[model samples]
Target: MPRILIAILLSCALSWPGIAQAWGPLGHRLVARLAEPRLTPQARAEIDRLLAIEQASSLADIANWADDLRANDPDLGRRSARWHFINIGEHDCAYDVAHACPNGDCVVEAIRIQADILADRTRPDAERLQALKFVVHFVGDVHQPLHAGYARDRGGNTVQVNLHGKGTNLHSLWDSRLLASARLGEDAYEARLRLDPDPLPAGTDPYTPGAPAVWAEQSCRIALAPGVYPPRSRIDDDYLLQHRPTVERQVQLAGARLAELLNIVLATEVSR
Candidate 1:
């Protein structure tokens, strides 16, 4: 795509009200926070080295940095707006690189690209640090089902619905409403999540080479589940009861996978 057209398309996409409603800061932070304690020692050390460059404390501190770029740094944000999600729904949740991740702008590819940059020790700390932030944020995004949903509704941003009589879109429904309905603060929510019997994948490779695409496929399937879209415009308690577990599980997995990805990425960094 030409630079001007890319800019115009992204401008319209970003201009959509609540297009960002997916995985609010709390959701992003929750993923990063969950991964902190799970990181391998080596990964933690490397992460610390990078975080120091920014005077940051933990991955959670930079979790939402990507999402905030449009407001905090307009130029880069405009260039990166499309990096957060993909339209795999058109392909039945199966990723077709040409169709789903064209031009390598979507979240799945973004994760890989950023991870590569992060894993290259030859790269400057500033470059790797930004890549680390992108990987963290994009991982959280891909796990949000709609981020990989069909393109019909722009990953549900255009699918209007109601919760408690308030108007919102499906993207926001999952992004904030369903997660927020629990009525617990993020720390409290973390406590509840840690209690899950299956908090992390068992007997599976955390550092799977097919990560971001695989994650996106799983999420797209969830978004395509029967009745995921409410039968009517008004959403009800049953909607929350049905999908909240899915939301929570995705968050947990994102964190788990992030820790694993970091452990491997940093461990395999090019020799200093």
Candidate 2:
């Protein structure tokens, strides 16, 4: 290969790793922050103990650990990158494990696996800590509508769009743009989301059997919802206005569900 061509290939290789994350840092931190206060006392203590292995102060501090690992740890990154999302068909909003995720390697399956590991007391603390990080991140990934979108577009990574005069792909737009467009800091965003009327009732458990599948399906439905996919790849204030509620709701749901999963898995002592 010519020197220039080799350089171009190397650049693409470096950039690809950066783009593999969902929700970006702010969104993941927001989810972790929201879930933090909701954890049961036992769950909180367990989380703190496990996280101390890395000398982290809070869930939010380590919320993006999985994404960071993708760039710094090549072997682990290659093995885990695909666990971030699953691809359903363009016309299909339902999740069929056999068809959509045949290998059981997608986000839904990742969540289930991590939850089990987190709940297994016999596992090493370091192993359970890694599971906790994934459970935090994948829960947020499942709530991002495009993460559960059609594979034809690589979850909209190929669908270019101009939002508010800035050029970007649909996946990046949902991953960070819309949330950033709100212009609210993380605390403000969390506070605003707290006011949403659709509360997770006091005793709700979001981790029932098949619940991860249900969550991914809901995201697929949102991706296919009217006005979500703009014609001609141009989005303006109207599009943002239309979808802001969905974004807010998804974040809220992710946070609440993450808390429920942690409470169940971490609060109770797991019998070997």
TM-score of each candidate?
0.91, 0.91
lDDT of all the models against the reference?
0.86, 0.82
Q: Give the number of the best model, judged by lDDT.
A: 1
**Candidate that would win on TM-score:** 1
Candidate 1 residue-wise lDDT at 125 = 94
The 10-residue segment with the lowest total lDDT in model 1: 13-22
lDDT (10s digit) by residue, model 1, range 206-267: 66557788889999999999989888999889989889999999999998888889988887
Local error of candidate 2 at residue 98 (angstroms): 1.9
What would you estimate as the lDDT of candidate 1? 0.86
Report the C-alpha lDDT of model 2 over 1-59, residue by residue, as the tens digit. 89999999877664442354678888898889888878898899899888899999898
Model 1 steric clash pairs: 89-150
